[model samples]
Target: MDAQPSGRAMVSRGTDTFCATDGRPATHLPVFDGSLPIMTEQPMVIEDSYTGHVSPGSAPQRRTVPGATITKMSVGPMDNNVYLVVCSATGKSVLIDAANEADRVNQLIGEHAPSLDLIVTTHQHGDHWLALEDVAAATRVDTAAHPLDADALPVRPDRLLDDGDTVTVGEVTLDVIHLAGHTPGSVALALTEAGGGRTHLFTGDSLFPGGVGKTADADKFASLLTDVETKLFDRYGDDTVVYPGHGDDTTLGAERPHLGEWRERGW
Candidate 1:
């Protein structure tokens, strides 16, 4: 057994290989010993199927898809999830929600992608952009956010994103979906594969695993829920994966059935 920097242990037992993190064993896979019937081809592995859990001082998790690779890390006292999306073909990358801990964010960017192109603030929340100024200055990357929340940011956004607007990272294109309620300018970025393989939604604070984000009043809640239903649930399919600003991830299918419950509970 060998220990990894990410607090994970790689173990090889008999003809099986697996990883254990925090004393939790991962899925086991068959390994070939010095025996006959050796597999000629490598087994298909899905690295993107992560549990989306990160601690303040822990290593980040990476998920690679067809066109892009996403790196997720948690920072600050609020446990904000900062995501870095890098285009596979061009190496162009974008950082979403610089959140907090500028040193950590800058270090990760330097290690993974030194030439970060853009830093996108999902909204004007203080927790989301705590490290925005420092990271942007360190990387010298352009910033983007919804116009409604632009004034609240530490720095003005180079590009003001509106609903249905598109932001490109190399060959990959991200569609901006304006989800009002959590904040006036709360937005989500949706990236769909070329052949419609899977649509990834990076929903800052608008959507989450159990329900939509918090709203100030009943009116705001209504607007948020309606917009989420019409724009998100109605437009996307069940397989669409949702990455929120905080905590773990979920799919549209997992939260679709609870829309009515959310509406009734008035949260």
Candidate 2:
């Protein structure tokens, strides 16, 4: 798991390069014990198909996902993607990655907030959670995130979310995933909108179009890719769209064609 042990290029997905898979502590998912688990990184599955809607906003564009309305917000030094996940049926919403711009977060929440069910952070990084306090203060809702990243919040989470945990916004449910590459606490969310059987993954920093997250710790990097290959790729088809923390959104299929190359690059 430690950076593939010598960066030996593995022949995978028609590419030749050393992909980073550092076997960091965060990367290693815990073995399920009988008792209440200290940390969980299991991938969640959607139980039902529901419809969701994203209210039109200043962004001027609203896209629809399997069972939810997807509103994309441009935020952060990296222009980190912030998503307003709302369920159409019950009008419940979840805020993803409130990285700074407190005023904007407040404004959006005040104007279009729908029950503000949960505030989900991608990781503990400053850029991804700068405005977490403001958003939480304004909405007075519970927060959900990877076990490792929960400490980033000003207030501890009311409850902790594991990989398989399901978060509901209105009627829509998002499955939690711990990718844990960009940081020990890195996580992802997967959900399907109505009318479409396809799934979408919000891969915070574990994955990007043609690059993987870089890591100084080889162990951590290995854990990241292992989860990506097994938990993410095994469960989700190449067709699933990848909404990353920064940069343009891409699909698993789109990235698959370049997985080997990306791995070698040690992104």
Candidate 3:
């Protein structure tokens, strides 16, 4: 894990290259040999964009799919990405990854707090749930995670999501896809619009834009990669929008063609 490049972008001089938040390949981005620089807070504002409404003056984040609106907020020292998945038709929503900063997360909920029905922790990694307990306590909403990772969380999850289980927000239901290796209980959520619209895949730390998530070793990497390819690429088409836990959002189409390249390089 230490081999993973820090989030900051710096001059390149190392073998360990890192991908930019956008979908660019690591070979095309900067490589750093030190820890990611200290993360600085920046003002984030919601503004309408072509893909969706993004937090302008900060990192470009947010995705508006057919039936839901997705928003991202980076928090904590680790720069964990938290997402808000809201159903546009019913306003019912779910908050994914309350990594840290309880007040900031609660504020993101804003007036829609009441419509929030679930607090989903993608996995039990401490960085992914530093503010889980506080946020869950404040929202008074049921928390959910895979049973394998539930025990690792600071707060007990009210709902245990299985591989094929589905959770509903108003009229929309999100299908759960269990993707392990990154963590024993890592999972991705998929949503399809009622009338055959675009599909959205929320991969916690399993899949990313340039490549798959960081694994402890080659075997773990292979397992994560295999799962992603079989369950995601092979199953979903190029149109599926991918909202990863960290960095920027990308689509399956932008990443599908590089599967062989990523596997051979063994990042």
Candidate 4:
């Protein structure tokens, strides 16, 4: 994706004109004077529903589950989705993909979570870790990633995650499921409710709304499809919500019927 230029405007006060950094036009603002009070930008109001569509520079959407609260934000030039999972009981949190825009990610952490315990990188793709080092250094939190892709990350992961391994935040536990294809160690994290309420799967780039993530060849595609079918689709129910690393969110129920189509198309 092409980078978006920062919005700027020229403000004229008295006989002098100066540049101002704001999306709003100078015509929209009242004339500035020494006697006038400064106007502060209002905070973006978060929406209630989880529509699965968020754009860069927009407010993050949030969803509250049985034991945790999940906040989704779209960041960077690639529009990578960054998720913040916070345990409702203890306020301890886990961040999934500090994808990009360190300043924006830090602002999100400061506003939404009480404490960030760990940051998990789903894969070693450059787009997925544009802000990982900065966020990790700022938060001073432990990091986790699959060993296969660990060496490629900017900051070495403190913990090497494997399939069946569980990551905990306060009282909530997320089960890791390795889905290889897009990368050597691409993984997905699943958080199942106590009963049979709903399961939320953070599939990273492995699974998206319409199909599996991109792969280099037929063999890789097959490997990803197989892992996704058995480890994800087969095990989880139709109601399972899928949160991908990019774009909008989806559910297994929504994409279940198209598994055959995706396989036949080989992508």
Which candidate has the top score in TM-score? 4
lDDT of 4 by residue, 1-267 (tens): 223222211222233322245535545666777797775534446676878899888889999888888999998878899999999999999999988887678767766777889999999988888888888876778999999999988899999999999999999999999999999999899998756589999999999988999999999999999999999999999999999999988899999999999999996
166: Cα error in model 2, Å: 0.9
Cα lDDT, all candidates: 0.82, 0.67, 0.76, 0.86
Worst 10 residues of 1 by lDDT: 1-10
Across 90-112, the per-residue lDDT of candidate 3 in tens digits comes to: 99999888876665676677533
Clashing pairs in 1: none
Query: What stretches of model 2 exceed 4 Å from their correct place?
Result: 1-60
What tens-digit string does per-residue lDDT give for candidate 1 at 132-181? 87777767779999999999888899999999999898988999999999
Whole-model alpha-carbon lDDT for candidate 3: 0.76
Candidate 4's TM-score reads 0.85
lDDT of 2 at 125: 70
Candidate 1, residue 155: lDDT? 86
Stretches of candidate 4 off by over 4 Å are 1-44
